[model samples]
Target chain A: MDVSNLGLIDFHAAYAIQERLVAQVASGEAPETLLLLEHPPVYTIGSGGSEANVLDPAISVVRTNRGGDVTWHGPGQLVGYPVIDLGRRGRDLHRYLRFLEELSIRVAGEFGVAARRVPGKTGIWTDRGKLASIGVGVRRWVAMHGFALNVAPDLEPFARINPCGMAGCPVTSLAREADAEPTVAEVAARVECLFPHLLNELLPCETETEGGRHVCCRLQVARGKAPLDVR
Target chain B: MATEITMPKLSDTMTEGRLISWKKGVGEQVNRGDIIAEVETDKANMELEAFTSGVLLETRVTPGELVPVGTVIGIVGAAGEAVAAAPVAVVPEPAVTETAAAAETAPAPAPEEPPPVHLSVAGEEAVKASPAVRRLARELGIDLQTVQGTGPDGRVLQEDLERLGGAGVTVAEPAAQPAVAETAPVAGTEPAAPRTELHDALPLSRMRSAIAQNVSTSWRTTPHFSVTVEIVMDAAAEVVRELREGGTPVSYNDLIVKACAMALFRFPQLNNSFAGDGIRMNADVNIGVAVGLPEGLLIPVVRECQRLSLREIAAESRRLAERARTGSISQQEISGGTFTISNLGMYGVDEFASIILPPQAAILAVGAVADRPVVRDGSVVAAKTMRATLSADHRIVDGLYVAQFLGEVKRLLENPVLMLV
Candidate 1:
């Protein structure tokens, strides 16, 4: 699997870029691309989520076509967008979410964050607070939008919306947990390292890339784009 | 005398709305302000008011179709009025003036061959359940057709699903062989005959599924820690007894709800929900009173509980509880609750923890109010007391906040007169 990592930026710019990429993927133009970015303090509602959960209407609330309820996103948060053909990678949304959650938990563990999955939720949480949020939109079995891990985000904006329909869970950041702020880029690199192991475990065909240092998998193809090769 | 019924704009941002369903069909006599149709706006679903008191002449928009605001959805007129002669026109393009003149002057073209009536077999004979139940079922991954509905017309009810047995059946059925083996008696020398079951296995009802999903989700996702507080309800019981003797029967649950509501005013954070990122302090103090019905528990909210007096809370709660029990509550009553209170006092429960309702940070579980010996002013006295527990999602509420919130509830309940003022 070919894994691509992007940088953090404002929510609208990131959303626009993701939207453009989605359109291309939907139009059968661009290869399946996983664009990672961050938002600058915003709340987004999922397909069937209620606006009532959004307590502060003055803040930006972007209505998204994702599965799950409303959640918050902001700067210092590592948001990963996996634009993969679910058909090519075994159309299992639950499996995909589990993998992302596992990866986040692993990443949080690297920093001694002690992150784990809440018994019935789809996100990763630390003993103190929620470390990451997950919401995805799958179009024609192709997945887009992904998890947002609080790296060093100012959690004040989370108060504006009911994150993932859980009204009162306080958002936490890796920086807050570590008691020292680490740039999202540094966290993202650490997270990217776990991707290879996750890809090999999740996908069937695995291969070594970059002088056998990293493992990768070439997913089966259907019609639109090249199979995702994650390393 | 055709009275055109256009879709009224429910919200400021609503340019177009989808007609969910028409409660009253064509030719149905409707009074003014009756909910003839349900419209889904951008923000929420709202009822379409029937401003005209007359017979519904015709329906212009089908359910589930989106139409612009002010679109002529239907027309009303006196019985026997020829409303069919009225010109049909879209809201933006009003062709009625010219079309009406043309119709009056020119003989109507022989009605084009009557179109074939296409009836949906899928819709006909399909199960009839409330939308909330269906939504709950879909979330819980339960098949509605399986549940044996006990509601009117065999409608699978939310309460029915909320029942402990109902949820146990759905949750345990997947591993039924193991469950049965564990619970059943050991086989004798002669293999025990399979338990005779008269009923067929049914799918989980939507409400049951939702309850399962929510309860399991809350338990699994949040690191829930509960703190119990014992309130000396001697004052509260006296107030209730006095009220009842004065011809105003009020429940202890009503007093608890009022006390909690008042406590929330002091600790607004308790009125919040866990929005994964942070706490969202709700603006309204709508209190969801958890009512135990045959199926399960339903928390019908008593909106603005802080504003209403104890008497008002009792009256409104009684009404809502009755409506919920009868399954006649309007959609409005079931939604928009900011906080919830669950009472198992009547069930003789000393104390029990409750799952936090999503979006709300905490839920107050009221145990039975009973007579207990307590030390008051250096003397042991038998006093009426009730045990209550507050379950808080650690992510949103800290230990101190929970303690403070519970303390306030204790103060208000101990001094019932303060709540009245």
Candidate 2:
């Protein structure tokens, strides 16, 4: 899978980028891609989710065609949109979503965060609360609209929503558990760094990685230092 | 009327703070200047005070919960007010102000009609796992509906797939010879069934989790550079042997600690930490000796290493490590380390660099000291020597400074009398 760090893009622009990349990858023009970026204060509702899930009446949102409930995304949150072609991997959508959640759980494990799957739930959770939300859309076996991890965001935007239509639990981030607050870029670097190895172990696409099982590429995601460019 | 008292943001970066303890309880008279509760922020523990003079109506937050600032943690209003359904006053986040401003320009678009849902019937009932799990099952050709779940509410955990090949009867039934050889183990001739009966998931202990998190964060964030040097331990070993013979029972580790203390005194710059904001040079020379345990490694720090003699350092080191191994070492016993020395000498490790512990600028990874043939003064002789690698955070200690510090340590270890004196 190709990973690109699109740091700090607006919601509309990122959505447009995903749309463009999804079409490209679906048609075999562009490589199967994972776009990592952060959007400004915005609430999003999937096709079937209720707008009422956006608790704050004034909260602005952009409707998208993805599977899940309403959720908020902002700065300090790492949003990964993987336009992966599952034609050769597997045609099952649930398995693909599980891979995304497992990938997230493994990354959180690196940070000493015990991120787990809540059995019937479709996201990642910690002892404190929900740590991540996974919602995706597919086109002819090409998956897009990936997962979002709360890194060190203001978290106030989360308070304005029920957080993926879940209730009675708080939303937590890595910074809250971390001794020193981590920046969005630092987390993005780790996600890009660890995701490949995890994908290799958890779900290896034989045609993609060749003989190399370990994706040990370390990235420095500070503005200009990161391997992947921010667009 | 009961007014909700919410969690207050103590700092700019603090999105949430844990309620350490409540100074007052329900129905207690809370006045201005009254420290109603103590909240622990990322930086420090702060006092949460009451602004209005009223009775503590209710405590919405319990101790140890890290809630967002302005969450309705308590109610401070009139006496006996019916707070049956306490209104959870949502603490407006600073980011919400930006969202609200954006709302005016683009008012929330009216609720759109729900899109048409497409439910796939392919393996619908058989797909009894999360999206990630189902895909892996399909890839491995293991049916999920056949696998027993170990997760909450009979949910198929990620680990259930491990037993899919053996325990799963239906999936493996069609694979040529069937699972008949696996089921009808011919009287102790089954090679003990490969010890793969049950699938188990081991949860991480708190200490293990802490070690993983701290080291991972440090390794990722810190820019480290290591310098290795071979130091002759003939003199230090003689001193240690002499001490053990004298009934003090000191080890090479104690001598190294003392030598490090003296070396740090000589080169104070290497003892400083790279705090990201600025370099902090520690006043007292405290050396943390890394003690390996089953759970993980614990570094118990020796305070005032400069004042303690060889015997005292040895005694204290033994006491602390013994306590740590026996699970008696408290947090205070293991904290506040300036520099660390990790010895893999006992394990026969030759020489390896280690990750620099966070907030501490440098750490010394000590290797085994044994009889090795070496060229001494041009002639090869069997000499007792130990190799050490010092990994220093480049953000704090300069290469020249670390080299000088390591040089001094080598000199002190070689002489062995200067530090003791």
Candidate 3:
């Protein structure tokens, strides 16, 4: 996994860059790339999401191809764009999802946010409010458009939309919880460090790539090395 | 006669469903129960079955399209029967055009001359554009609506908004404007801060909102009281061991479900639902086993549990659980339950209470069965015991009734062989 740290940018511009990058990887034009970005404050609706949940029409709403309903993104938020080749790592979306949740929980603890996964919900949430949101899109076994962690950005924008299609659950920021403002760059670095360990733990040891420098790795089952033999 | 295939409510909270795929295209013959399309609800992906056997005349919406609860997605009618001319298209045009004309004339006055002045504010005074283009430009925060379009009559379709970098337009008021924060003046000479709009506003997802409503209503409407009982599972555990030794594997939940079912036979009123006018005792003991799904909890009923054997109950529970996890359980599988059970035993929870499912007067919550030291015959002894709580709606059943009901359950669970009989 190649990590590129991008500072805060406009939501539309970030999405445009993501589309180009995903297309490039799909055409084998670029090696798997993960572009980390923070947005200027916007609400997005996924493929099956409804615009009706957006209470404020003034805010820009971008409909994207992902698996969840409506979610908010804005300044003071840390958004990770993971463009890794899952084919190189076993194509287990479930395990990948679990890794994402674990990474969020770990990063949240550093800021004393006390985040945990809601039993059936896919994101990390606190008792009073949600701290982070996760929605992903995969193409050709490569993942893109990952989780968003609320840092210091004004969460007032979240009130305008039913965040993640869930109502009554207020969105919270780390700054609000920690009572200290933290830059997006600071949070992204912590997240990048936390994700690789989780990825390695879930993937088989043989699947680890060369030198473990590049996170993308694939393993072919050896005859005797099979964990279990049916015969 | 033409039969309109409206969007069916796939779940209790689903008011609309997205057509994932049209399995049967237009002009194809379809029989009753034939899956014409796959509808993705908030909770799961469900197959839309044809309720009437006929030729699929027309598909109103394509795959990836969504329609409201009463919106017709397809038309089914006899062969050679002329389907009703897509009624939706005919209905919306006249009304929509009328409203569009009214909106154009009404809102044009207040912001009529402000566009030119607004264009100058953003440093783009030379641009000239139509009202529609101006509206799009304003929405994209673009002031370049003055750029001339090459389309017939210079009409803007969505691309023009994208081409302008979505900048330089001061036209219509922003739709769904965020609440503007009032900024205090830093100094007497300094201008007040620009009205900063905060937060992304969105509509509530029907499913999530419904869940909230149901939970709150359950707490408010039901005067619920819970009773916890510890069942010494030495006999039940031995019974399970013997059964496993005989090549029959069963879970503790299987025994609990069976025990609850057998106990319901003794106190039939406990196996009843609160009808609007009066209490309705169920003829059969159909127990709903709650299974947690990826999106939420779904309880699939094991119908006629009183007639099924332990092995049969185990098989049914396993089948229902697999179906719930795979998102393939039918509507009937979730409907028609007289009682429900939720288990947190695997999580090592020693005791917990559950909310009563609507219409069903009570629910049983099972916790971990563990070995604990207890005073047996006035001496301390390590005994295997499981804690179970029964939450009942007090409006429908009294404390004495619930006590008696719990007693019957305790007897059946303590005497494990009684369940088999």
Candidate 4:
């Protein structure tokens, strides 16, 4: 995976760059690349999001072609836009979402914040609140608009609207939960460092057995650290 | 053979998605890679593309209708294939579709839905009281039907019984009393109070109890400390004037909210909750503006202040304040506040600290902005000023951090234009 650290950038500018990279990766012209950066304070609603969930009418919201409700992006939050060709890996949006969630869980763990997925909810959460949000857009099986992890940004912006369309949703950051205050840049570096291992372990699971019967796959990371297998 | 098109799972959590619109109409020629329809998942909308070149034969779903993943939304086949051609092989099991439709269309289970009307055995209106309240009424020798309930839907409360004490109701002294304690009240036990006179014993309203419960919880659980700052609001006043003249009608309080949001963005620690062993940092900057109603206090949150401009904040604050004063504020409107700003400036107060709302780390109490003499560069000069006090959780943040956060707010307010970015 190729990694580029683009510090704080505008949402549209980064999105344009992502579309270009997505096209390149889709056509096999470029390697899978990760653009790690933060956005200047803005609220973005995906194609699946409703404007009704945005309670405050004064704030300008950008609607994008991504799956999910309204979400806020701004400084101090690490946004990882991975341009990867899922066509070659597996054209499985479900598996891709899980891959992103697992990657975020591992990254939060690196910062000493234990994060995991809640049943029926898409994102990484802790006892305190939601830590990372994953909303991906796939064009030609190339995924973009990946995930946003709260690092040390002001959470007050999330209050203006229901985060991810769930009212009274509590959004937390690594700096709030971890003993060590990790900057957005530091968290982005951690993601860049840890994503490859997580991708390898989570992406290649077979959804079917030798008998051709469909079986659910589970990642047993709790039993031991070294042994990883599909079950 | 007709190729079946099923709804795709665009996001991991999407079990169902709404069929937005059909880009290719039924019976239209569709080529491979052509956009077929638009589907809206819970989080986003995606364009479903045709995988096989064929004529659109039939559409099983309509626009704006939600269908489950793996349900055949449409079908494509040879141009001669009629729409009436049976596609039974591709149709989902009747039971599956029925259950999915039921789940999608059914209203959320309302626990508060009034109970089914029971046929009265004796044709008498049923008294609305809990079994426990009925049991207590039996012990207190009070007739429940005669008692005016203060609870929701006119249900009787325990406090209502205590208020009946001065009303000549006889108290049963025996521990083992018969269930027939529905005895008549003794005459001349106590003289009835004058109905026309002012009554001193006022029952606590539900709002009052709620306020008491919240403040008590915060007082007990949170270890709080306060920091006070005197802001020179000269530039902020000018900005307010310019905006009002420009028809924006922003107040000094709105300027304070924007400034505080910017400051909170820089000082994330102040926007965190002390969760015993660790601090829980909030994601959005929701600042609650305290609205003083005649009944009690209502802190309607001004959400996402970090993303809102001064004019926007002013409009939102004004709307919320209006709703609060009119008693039309909703539970959603007043909930989910990360920090609070309580201004008593209109009341002509100089400065006063406030209690931190629970689960939130801080609250800013603002005094009236008035003309005051201040020392600047060695000489006393008259400047418009305001004093703000921030009460914060000491467990989550120290005095130094609170002081610095307040200092940032002071800086933004003093400069005024610095908060625009």
Candidate 5:
């Protein structure tokens, strides 16, 4: 896995990088990559998201081809785009989402903050509020549009829209939960350190039969070994 | 042959998905990799690509329609080729409902002879048993067609299998079963095997029925282990009194909820649930305080206790309890409890263990805060003490974790000011 720390980049620039990396990885010209960056104040909605969730008409919203509702992105938040080819992997998109959540959970844990997954909801959360948001887009079995961790972002923008289509959803950050305030780069570093281990543990390469053609599919590592697979 | 396009499984956990829109219209030429539709799975929306090239012949489902995976949503075939009829057995219009004039003009086709009943032929007769009962019968090696159903409409039931098994028939019990003495206690106590005059049977109220069913389910499924701790509630009582004098109306249970929230923050395992094959760690410490009513009980939750102030929790718990007693509580108020606190302190009960609430890992049972003799400084002394037992699912947390959680709760209650900080 290749980790690039591209700090303070525009959302569109970061998305373009993700698109390029996805195409490269899908074509076997590049290794699986992790692009870490931060976006200026912006609100983005998933392709399936409803426009009615945006409470404030003034805030500009970017519609993207991802798998979640409207969410906020800004400088204080750490955005990570994991460009990986799922063809050689299990090709299970749900498991890929869980893998991203587990990465975020470990990153939060590195800062002495406890994060967990709420049943029937996608995101890593603390008791205080949700700590991270994850949405992905897959083109030809290549995943993009990864997760955003609230390191120390201004939560005011989130109140302008229903975060993940949930009304009155509370958002929290590492600065609030941890003993000391941490920067987005610091958190992204921890993510880069933890991503490969979790990816191997949760979404390891395996072989199984699919379409009755002896096509190799990934079998989940034993559930006990992969605790995050509880979802 | 026309190829049917079914909803694709986009995720491992998605049982069904919504068809957001069709990218291609009927009669549109489609290549093998053409995007045919967009689907909203449980996680996100993804484009559904065609696997084989053909012209779209029919659209079986409309946009925004939610259907189970593998349900055919469209048909694709060569140009000018007619699509095959759907596999569903189309029911013809009934001749029985026809008027007398229509029947006289054209004699209705002679009624087909009814097929001979073959009890052994599976799929010939539709069984009325639920999926669970059918599964149980299969596990017990009992054939549903042979067993006489005692339930309404002659439906085979779980109890029928039990009856068959007890009769020493074809049903085979698992080996290595422990032998129980005939003198074993059934239903706790059997009234000393003495006859008594029978009274009129009374039906269970809705609340009672719910309680019975819930507790039975919890007892049967949850492997519960309890740890008891004695806490000197002198400080907690003083804080409660101070709050009550200040018009906050704080109760002992409210203090316990505050303390439990703090302890749960430290030990997230206690706030977890025993999901099969793994555990679900709940992010919010939504403490459900069990409120006893005249008929039964209602546990109204004080949600996200980690964010609530002590005074706020007191007010919410009091309001919920009042609403529960008045039978005016909303569903949202009584649901989403990550942990539960059941107190019989008002009734002056000493101590008791509660059944672990399903999905939730643990329940804290708080006893009355009363004066009790304690040995302090190697001498007997009276102190305002209470006994609290934590019943937790062993599958999620062990006795050590439960003890540490209970100890933290005790530490917070004993040092009541720590909760404020």
Candidate 6:
């Protein structure tokens, strides 16, 4: 995972970075990149989104190609845009999404938040509503646009639109969930740091297993250790 | 024209779905019959396909966010033209507004319901606590179901309960209590609060959940009944002992598989699956031997068990079972089993009932061969006895037929030489 932190960047600028990185990755010009940053306030809807979801027409709404209904990306939220070539991997998009979710869940667990999967729902959830939202697009099997986990974000803009196209769906933050206000960088660093570790857990390393398959994957990162305070 | 791609109904029970991931990017050319996305429904993860040949336009829904069925998730249209024909207006500037910032101070998402305190589980007779706390509390003669936990999800912590009150509050007389025993909550109560605790949990793997879904469906729909027979294994045990002693190692389970295959002839109902249209009697008496793995249970069938001699039966079953354990067993090996045998005899389990695999009519649960007293002629004498249970799908297998089939198995096993031939 080639991860870059473009701290507190403009939404369109970050999107350009994503596009550039995606093209580079697809062309084998650069390695897969995971771009993490906080976007200034913006309401983005997909092409399939209904205008009815955008309550306040004045809010800067960028129509994106990413999957999902309208969503809010602002200062406190850490938006991760992974410009990764999926063809080199299994090219299984659903499994890739589940890996992203598992990464978020593990990151939440580091902060003592009991995040879980709701049966039919997409996002990582606590008893509180969704804690994060994920949307991505792929071209030639190269993925772009990723997850947005609420860190210390102002969730008020979420009320302007039916977030995730569902009315009255409550969005939560890492700080709110953990009851400690950690910076978006800290959460972003944590999720970025834990991403590959969690990815290998779900996707598995089949090539290594080929040598001797009978032995179970006998490795675990020691738990109950303090999360590295990368803030 | 850019056409909207809405959420497709993945299953009968599906009301909502999570877009797991998108396979197509904006401006990516996609043809009809190409899979464009994967959505997770209540039952399983289903593949979503592109219905029209076009370039992917825009996706409206993000992965991990749940939306209802028929919610438009993406659009597809002619590539360069679609980019010009905007679906929705991109507002120039999102107003950083007044009411929005104030809305933060408005109220936190419905001031979350205060977390609940843990309560005692009554009639369980055992304290609802962790093994560590439950043991510690019992050593102090304290009832676990009596304490309220302050820990996460109301789980009783040892430190919290230890600081409750007086130490070693003996509920039972020391003379009456046995040493190092799992204390059951007795009738009389010197109870304070019931002990409640929670343990860590991991999400069930897809394999585990699939096993759960399949077996649960089998359990709910099938009407099941079990019949037991204790065959005095004096002769059968001798046959096994002789085989081991003769350097050809074979197990009692192997002998039983052979016996069951022979019994299939006497009772053909055991070898047939009940199709809704009619009973499909399989020509081959392929026996499925249940193999337990760390992840889940698998049944590998040893085909044409009746044709194989006792020695051949032993080798084939072990090979199939070993492959099943190593996770290399093929689809053909796992399927077409007309009968199944689940043995916990090695674990010292006696006469345990088992569930029948779907479509197949019967499963034999074999128990340990033990030395017990049985009447021979007039007086009760010490003899080796083994219990075998037949859990049959009652829709097809009648009780009397099950009895006759079990009787035949007993005769075949007790006359141990019959299986060798």
Indicate which candidate wins on TM-score: 5
Q: Cα deviation of B167 in candidate 5 (Å)?
A: 48
The number of clashing residue pairs in each candidate reads 36, 7, 34, 19, 1, 23
lDDT of 2 by residue, A1-231 (tens): 689988889888988888898779868799778899998777887655667677777777777767667888888889998877665453544556667777788777777787766434667877577788888765545667889998888877777787776543478888887667777787778888787665454444433232323323232122222111000
Candidate that scores best on lDDT = 5
Higher-lDDT candidate of 5 and 6? 5
Residues B137-165, model 3: lDDT tens digits: 43233446455556566655446654432
Candidate 6 fraction of reference contacts recovered: 0.00
lDDT of 5 by residue, A191-215 (tens): 8878766776676653333221232
Model 5 regions lying over 4 Å from their true place: A206-227, B61-65, B80-272, B276-336, B339-358, B361-421
The order by descending lDDT is 5, 4, 2, 6, 1, 3
- Fraction of true contacts reproduced, model 1? 0.00
Q: Report per-candidate DockQ.
A: 0.02, 0.02, 0.01, 0.15, 0.23, 0.01
Q: Model 4: what is its DockQ? A: 0.15
- For all candidates in order, state the fraction of native interface contacts they contain: 0.00, 0.00, 0.00, 0.29, 0.35, 0.00
lDDT of 1 by residue, A25-48 (tens): 757687666666766666777655
Segments of candidate 1 deviating more than 4 angstroms: A1-231, B1-202
Candidate 4 - CAPRI tier? incorrect
Total clashing pairs in model 2: 7
| Tens digits of lDDT, candidate 6, B70-168 | 445666766653221111111112112222333233321211111111223462144345554543443223455556667776666776555542122
Considering every candidate listed, which one attains the maximal DockQ?
Answer: 5
**Model 2 docking category:** incorrect
lDDT string, candidate 5, B161-273, tens digits: 65553111222222222334344545655455432111122335546656776788789989999999999999888988887798778878888999999999999999988
Candidate 4 lDDT at B201 equals: 21
| Regions of candidate 4 where Cα sits further than 4 Å from its true position | A205-231, B8-21, B25-29, B38-47, B55-58, B77-81, B85-421
Question: lDDT tens string, model 6, A1-231?
Answer: 578889988888988888788778868799777888988888887644557777777766788766666889889888888776655443455656666677778788887787865423566777577898877676655778888888888877898887876657778888888967888878887977776555445544221121322212233233323232110
Instruction: For candidate 1, write residues B180-267 as lDDT tens digits.
Output: 4555567688777675231222434436645765787678887888999999998998999998999998989989989998999988
